[model samples]
Target: MARHIYACPLRWSDMDAFGHVNNVVFLRYLEEARIDFMFTQAAEAGAGEFAGGSVVARHEIDYRRPLVHRPEPVTVETRVTRIGGASLTVAYEIKDTAADGTETVYVQASTVVVPYDLAEGRPRRISPVEREFLSRFMDEEVVAV
Candidate 1:
């Protein structure tokens, strides 16, 4: 399985008055993880490099639990679930791996990212390098528990 892991140190500002991470913060975390993953692939595989910019076309998140900001490290697992002609779908699982296992899922999310020619402001095809990098994580069967 192609898995991209990003450990984020929770910020004090990420917490809400309710004593847990605000719902919106989770998406930011996922986005960070996706960036880390793709960049890592670019460095390793030497192909499928995404030199272009990305835009989110769709997002779906399922919040499974609330986690308090402990200023600790949290892991976000990102994978490419699908790649379309002009878009890529990234799925993420956020968990407090320090406190619990994958069973302690804090949040689950999927984002559809489309390539954009920044200068032209138009949709573009996935570059050969990017497509190669994303192929490793395409529509896998093993679900994160």
Candidate 2:
């Protein structure tokens, strides 16, 4: 399966007094990556409707290691874990890969997102187009957060 990869830059302000990236900021990182995947990339594939409206039904995250702010961007890899009738689960890993091919994962998380009908003011089911787009990034191994 393919994964949507985003290079997320770390800002100095994202660091906590203790010097590591604050736990809360990781949520923002996830949002940035998710928006790129569901909105930017999906839109290019004709599933732009997802950009119109979507709600985060739930978020589950596990902070595996402390991440300090650095000049290089961290990699956030996103994949589809489960796609339901009205919602879909996307899993993510925030990590750095060394030249030696070792990976250091700082966070593992998943978010349940529901498409919404902005005009109707309610949640909507996944359309065939959206489902087809999401299926391209499907993976069986979901991070157990």
Candidate 3:
């Protein structure tokens, strides 16, 4: 599967008093990558259909290591793990780059997102075009920590 990579800049505020990234901030990183993948990589029409068309139904995250505040960018890799009738699972890995150029994974996460219709106030089926665009990132194997 093709993973969409996003370079996430770590903010000082993202760290806690322990000098490592706060656990809650990891969710933000995942959200950024998900938005970038869906809105930027997907087609314009498909992207439009996604506007307020999805909601995170669940989030499962495993923190492997602590991430310290750094000037270098962190990398977030995102891919579609499963696509169902009304929802899809997006897997993510947040990694920090070291001076030696090694990447250490800090977190592994997955989010179940359901396509929603605001006007009708309910879940909606994934459109064919949207599925086609999302298939580009589909992976047969599940991503785990």
Candidate 4:
């Protein structure tokens, strides 16, 4: 499957009481990766200005292992699994290069985001241009929502 991956360094705040990357922080890393991929690296895949007009309809996160805080950096990988007219489902993976075993998969997350009418505060169908733009993330075949 085709995928979009974004990499970033781990920050000091990402550590927890155990001196390893906290579980909750992984979700935040996923969020940052999603935003970067959709807006910067692949702006062509974004619908429109979703900062204040987007709504997250559903979210799922799976933690595979604990990330130890090391002097080196960790990377977050993100990709869009599928996209509908109004909704897009995105996935993420966080990993540390030094880690071995399943500890490789530090985190995984899936999120469904929908465009909304900022004025009416209700869900809305994506615009034609936006729909065309977002299709780039798909697997060459459109999936029904």
Candidate 5:
């Protein structure tokens, strides 16, 4: 079991009038991290087809703390929680780790993604290669519900 780590930069525009990152912007952060994981990293692992067409079927997010804009990037750790026949669920934690090794989690979320056949215009089953790539990051203990 492993976790994919992404360094997500914070932009000034992500801040809301209240001075913390807006709720909606967190979705974008998650997208960036998910893309890095499922597209870039997966392709390198021989699951390049995921980049062709994968759609988010559902998102479950819990905002744990407010995050103000900062120059340093926040850490987004992603892991596969469940893999269905046609869809997979990924869990994420957006956080900052201090020098002392303490972690301040800003958000905990999960997303259900379905592979799609763009040419055929419909969903598809999880390919063996794709499943193999995703299995590397699967964590049995982190069940998303």
Candidate 6:
């Protein structure tokens, strides 16, 4: 399986009173990674399949460690874990890289996204092309959060 990686910058406001990234801010990181994968990478791979926007039906996240403010960007790696008829599951891992190149995982997350047709006001099935595109990043093994 192939994982799409996005480098998300840390903002000063993301830190909380404890001097670490707030729990709520982790969702933003996952959202950024998902948007980059679906709207940017997948769209560029091919269009017309995912013309309509997707909605998050569910989100699951597990925090392994607190992320402190850092000069370097945090890495978010996303991959398709399951592809259903109208919904797909995306798994994510948030990590902070150290100066020596080591990485510390901060969180593990997943989101269930449903493709929707705004004009029709309903969820739509995954087209063959879209399925193929998603398959490129599909992981056979389940995420071990």
lDDT of 4 by residue, 1-145 (tens): 5566666667887888888888788777777776776555544445446654777788898888777766666677666677787788877777755534444777778889887789987888766666555565665566646
**Compared with the true structure, what per-residue lDDT tens digits does model 5 show for residues 16-96?**
999999999999999999999999999999899889999999999999999999899999999998988899999999999
lDDT (tens digit, per residue) of candidate 2 on 86-130? 899999999999999999999999999999999999998888888
- Model 3 ranges off by over 4 Å: 43-46, 97-102, 141-145
lDDT of 4 at 141: 68
| lDDT, candidate 5, at 106 | 96
Ten residues in a row with the worst lDDT in model 5? 136-145
Task: Enumerate residue pairs that collide in model 6.
Answer: none
Question: Which pairs clash in model 5?
Answer: none
Better of 1 and 2 by lDDT: 2
Clashing pairs in 2: none
Top TM-score prediction, candidate number: 5
**TM accuracy, model 4:** 0.77
As for candidate 1, its clashing pairs are: 47-129, 48-129, 48-130, 49-129, 49-130
lDDT of 4 at 101: 46
lDDT of 5 at 142: 27
What value does the lDDT take at residue 68 in candidate 4? 72
lDDT values for all models: 0.77, 0.92, 0.84, 0.71, 0.92, 0.86
Compute the lDDT for candidate 3. Answer: 0.84
Pick the winner on TM-score between candidates 3 and 5. 5
Task: Return the number of clashes found in candidate 5.
Answer: 0
Clashing pairs in 3: none
